[model samples]
Target: MDYRQRRRIKVWGKAEYVEGDSALIERLRIPGYPAKVERAILFHVEALSENCSQHIPIRYSATEVEAMMAPLVARIEELEQKFVGE
Candidate 1:
């Protein structure tokens, strides 16, 4: 989910607000295979400066991503509970 905040990301002499960023994973199953093939998707945040460009890929392993996202997820949940009065 993208947070609607006044955070700006600058690139190549131009600046743009951070639209959003999300993590995704891909898995595939093969015929007669005993296990599913899994892959971690690597992607760069895109921005339009002089032209459309991509930032450095988030090159993190699955475990690392989970560890990094935990606090953020908990914070979001806490905020949600507060907003809904739960």
Candidate 2:
């Protein structure tokens, strides 16, 4: 249709987690900025239910990465609401 309408996306993750002997030992990541933005957490754990941020990464700690991904994430969400009917 239009250029703007054609250029929208969704935030998807080829994400993963790394578990050790400890309770909080996993991660969630997405292609962020020009690199990968890593999020360490307990994503699917039930007993201690709900997601807990381990060491708690600042959402926009890396300036370059945050700057790059900020617009991308926003566009993706916008596209989701527009196209995916989310």
Best by TM-score: 1
lDDT of 1 by residue, 1-86 (tens): 11223233454343433322322222233467765445433335465434222433335568888999999999999999999995
Backbone clashes (count) for model 1: 0
Candidate 1 has what TM-score? 0.32
For each candidate in the order shown, give its overall lDDT on alpha carbons. Answer: 0.51, 0.48
| Per-residue error (Å), model 2, residue 75 | 0.7
* Per-residue error (Å), model 1, residue 63: 1.0
> Tens-digit lDDT track for model 2 on 1-86?
12222332233334345545233322333335465343353345334222334433444347768888989999999988898773
Best by lDDT: 1
Worst 10 residues of 1 by lDDT: 19-28
Name the Cα RMSD for model 1.
18.9
